[model samples]
Target: MLLPAASTVFFTQVFAGTPGGVSPEQAAATMVAMMAHGAVGAALGATVRLSFDRASGWLRQLRVTPVPQTSVVAVDVAVGMLLTLPPLVVVALTGRFLTGVRLAPGEWAGLVGVLWLGSAVFVALGLLLGWALEERAAGGAVGIVGTVLAALGGLWVPVELFPSGLRAVAHGLPSYWYAEAGHAAAAGRLPPAAAVAALTAFVPAFGALAAVVARRRSLPAVAG
Candidate 1:
């Protein structure tokens, strides 16, 4: 997290002061978007971990323990949420001190809080993939999946830089809305209704799908 934040700050510094230099506000917005990207993409590891546990029969072993399956799943998602903090704090600090982008303390808190909450969509996605796919397949797919989501979501390049058609497509993605929410919060405003609605819809949709997959996967163990 620190490494990525440092690299972004370095790039922002290099580009500052030129004719087309990144403005402080743009840099701040980019940092906020990147924070959301890192938070959502962080769950890719949970996919791999879940796949490995399933492959190793650890999930099956857990069935014999006293802990409920819902508890196990909740713990995994909660851990993913916790993972978002490091990147959020690192990038917030990097933008504040290194890049000279300032936000009120309340704005910073709101920014972090929004991105952290929106991350549930992808965390659920990671869990769904882990539960649904083979270990080797999940491992191979996660990197490509994360990269594609980030690219299309406008984290790697600003949507403003994209061609018109691509920009239209970006508006439809949950990742795009996720970043939009970050941008809004960083600016000390409520996230757009579209962003809030998109995130609200995805969270439960992905979570329900993941839950269904987990229940299906556990059925064989229960019957055995």
Candidate 2:
């Protein structure tokens, strides 16, 4: 969770006097971006854990237990939402204490809220992966997908550094919007409407797709 924050510190220090050195301000934004990346990546655990649960037949058992499918999914989503916060809180603290970021109280609250909400896209994505893949494949898929999302979304490297074509492509990803939304909130502004809309659209899009896939597989029904 803190690995990305730590790496940001290390890289900023290493390049402090170089032409490529990051400004203290940009470093702070980068840290926030990395935090967003970590939160979404952590949310991917739902995929691996659920795949294991499926392999163990726990989901099948739930079907026989009279549990409302909506209750089951709500619990899973609630757990995933909770899982995202530790990194957000700790990393925000590190930014304040270690990196000397100084946002207003409202800015802090807005930033946390935006990032937390943005993670819903990945949480829904995790459920999709969970329903779609076997346990053995889920872990590797999460690793690859998370890394690719981070890289392409400009979480690891700024989109400013990308070629024009690639930057255009990055602008289309939810992860890119996720970090952008965080950055906007951290700077004391409402998140960009386009970003918020894209993320909003993706949650149900991924969710609806997951429901269809799960139904086709004859797994337990997933509540929307």
Candidate 3:
């Protein structure tokens, strides 16, 4: 949260006024994607923290309780989405009043909706990582994954500035589609159907990964 929020403030202030910037729209376009990307980091934080719970055998205790593990996961994802809101309000408010970037009501609707959908994609990813990685490794893994995705996915830098090859790679990442969707929404235009479809598809695909990990976690350990 600190990293993304701090970086967002720095990057937007520094880059929003680049010389001969091809598009003023692009210059002021950080808020939408930044909000969603921050949510991904928050989701990862929740997952990594829960990984410690699993390591400490708290999850084993949960098995005796009435709550389904899926319910726990759902709660975590919802909390992750909520975690995104404050940073977004802060960043958007700063962008508008401090940086002079603005969005219309409709554009705000699209940006926030698309951003949340994007966060949903990563919430699933975070769940999978939490279940799959050992507790000792989950924290480092979460940081690395979030940073790499944000850097390459154009959450920090616009995808347009990437070299052709790098741009191709960025397009293949879910983060790229997330950022692109936000960009489109902010411009008061819908993102391409393919981009929207890709983010939608990723949510289920990553959810399946988490489901697989959850099943394994529930299995009895084999004796040597």
Residue by residue across 1-224, what tens digits does model 1's lDDT show?
86558766766876786788988787897688768767766866654478778777788888789999789887888887788778878888888887888899999899989888888888888888888888789977888878888899898788999999999898878889999999999999999999999989988887788778877774234233
Q: What are the Cα lDDT values of the candidates? A: 0.81, 0.83, 0.74
- Judge candidate 1 against the unseen true structure and give its global Cα lDDT, from 0 to 1: 0.81
Name the top lDDT candidate.
2
Q: Can you rank all candidates by TM-score, best first?
A: 2, 1, 3
TM-score of 1: 0.91
User: Which residue ranges in model 2 land beyond 4 Å of their true spot?
Assistant: 19-21, 219-224
**TM-score against truth, every candidate:** 0.91, 0.93, 0.87
* CA displacement after TM-score superposition, residue 6 of candidate 2 (Å): 1.5
Evaluated at residue 194, the lDDT of candidate 3 is 82
What is the lDDT, from 0 to 100, of the residue 57 in candidate 2?
A: 74
lDDT of 2: 0.83
Candidate 3's residue-wise lDDT over 67-149, tens digit each?
99778777778876676666656666655665566788887767777676667787788878988888789989998999899
Q: Which ten residues in a row have the lowest lDDT in candidate 1?
A: 215-224
